[model samples]
Target: MILTLTPNPSVDRTIAVATLTRGVVQRATDSRMDPGGKGINVSRALAVNGTDTVAVLPVGGPQGQVMEDLLRAIALPVETVRISQAIRANVGIVEPDGTTTKVNEQGPRMSADEVAALLAAVDRAAAQGLEWLIGCGSLPPGLDGSFYADLVRRGHAVGAKVAIDSSGAPMAAAVAAGPDLIKPNDEELEELVGRRLATLGDVVEACRTLIAGGVGCVVVSLGGKGAVLVTADQVAHARATITDPLSTVGAGDSLLAGYLHALTHGADPATALRTGVAFGSAAVCLPGTEVPTPADVAKIDVEVVDPVDLDLPL
Candidate 1:
């Protein structure tokens, strides 16, 4: 089973409007809410395709209750650690033209005891034979960037492959622990490498730097242009044919879910790249933060090529 840890979870409320005008009243055409946080979203997406997964997070206050209710309705297995502060709520405004504007909260703070309890839960889950242990999203207020790094170490000790999708110092710390996989978009990778990757060569070079530093694999998401997967042995580029895009929220999480699912199921890296891109593209066509189903995966036309041109355009 795949296990995900989201230290800071949220209730994501999405509202649809014809147009978003500043300093004026607007009527909502429709609205929906879902469980938020990168790891949580990954688990939700995995459940969409009948993958066995569980989410571990801290829940508190009224909003946390709402989050639990939503997860229950979707039949997601979750392990919770109680916290004192109320979990945050995020708002998203989506226009008919597929424009999305978001307002996010910093989320609740976790005390030392609370953080330790959460890690212990991960340890217990890993002991139960978890194939993948994913540490995602940002570190909450009181926790240092070393939180994800600790997760990488703990997961590795239990023989569980660790995959991380986070930014800033937390990501840097996790990289130092040599995670099995990392999923970073172009912007996040650029920040990590401290360079301007204006070409595919530059991007691949940066990913290779990570591989050399002991990271087992690096997957770079290039938004609508598709994604590239890099390992010590091979490199592959994959793009999918998608039409009528909707909201782009949770697309990256879907990509990671698909990639990890394929890897755990014994698919080759190239095939995993194709499945990851297809899942991401299918996610972009759905409204709000919804993930793709099996039908969406079958409908995707994916193109994957190995030994990509080093000097190709970005």
Candidate 2:
């Protein structure tokens, strides 16, 4: 069973407008709401793809109840820890031109005991037999940067491979702990290594540096340009076949889900990367956090290029 932990989950409200204007009232043409959070998205994607996934998160207040009801309505398997504060709500305004403006809440302020409770919940879930553990998204208020690191350590202790997708100090700390895999978009990758990445060579160098630092594998996702996969022995570049862009939101999460699913199913790294890029590209072709179907992935053209050894500054 795949277990996903979301420290800061939210209710996502998406509104569609013809255009966004500054300091003006714009009527929304349509509105929709769903579970919002990185780990939630990953679990949803996996579940849609026929993978058995359990979404473990902290929920509280009426808003949290609404979020849980929404997930249950969608038939998602969820395990939640009740907290004191209410969960957050994120708003996304999508323009007719396919541009999306997102406003995210910082989420609830978690207490130390609350954080420990969630970790304990993860332990319980692991004891029930977890094949893979995925720690994704940002740390909520009052939580330490090493939160995901702790999860990685615990997952490893339970003989489960851990995959992390996050940013800032949390991501850095998790990488230092050496998760089995990490999916960082181009921007996050640049931030992690403290440098500007302008080319594929730059991305490869960054991945190599992370691997040398003890990360098992690094997947750097480049919007439109596709993704780069780096391990100790090889670095492969996979490009998307479909070029027509719709929405770029949630593409990275979908990619991580696809890749993790493939890896868990015993596919090689190259095959997994190809599947990931395909899912990512397909996601961009759809609207709002919608993941690609296996049929969509099968139709995508993915080309894996030879590893390029570029001299880069560590």
Q: Name the best candidate (by lDDT).
A: 1
The 10-residue segment of model 1 with minimum total lDDT is 305-314
**TM-scores of all predicted structures:** 0.97, 0.93
TM-score of model 1 vs. true structure: 0.97
Model 2 worst lDDT run, 10 consecutive residues? 305-314
Give the per-residue lDDT of model 1 (tens digit) for 1-314: 99999998889998999999999999999999999999999998898888889999999999989999999999898888898999989998998766899998999988899998998888777777888999999888989889888889988888888999999999999999999999999999999888899977799899999999989999999987799988998889998756677788889999999998787788998889888898988888888888889898778888876568777777
Q: Estimate the TM-score for candidate 2.
A: 0.93
* Candidate 2 segments exceeding 4 Å error: 241-244, 306-314
Number of backbone collisions per candidate:
0, 0
lDDT of 2: 0.85
Shift in Å, residue 182, candidate 2: 0.8
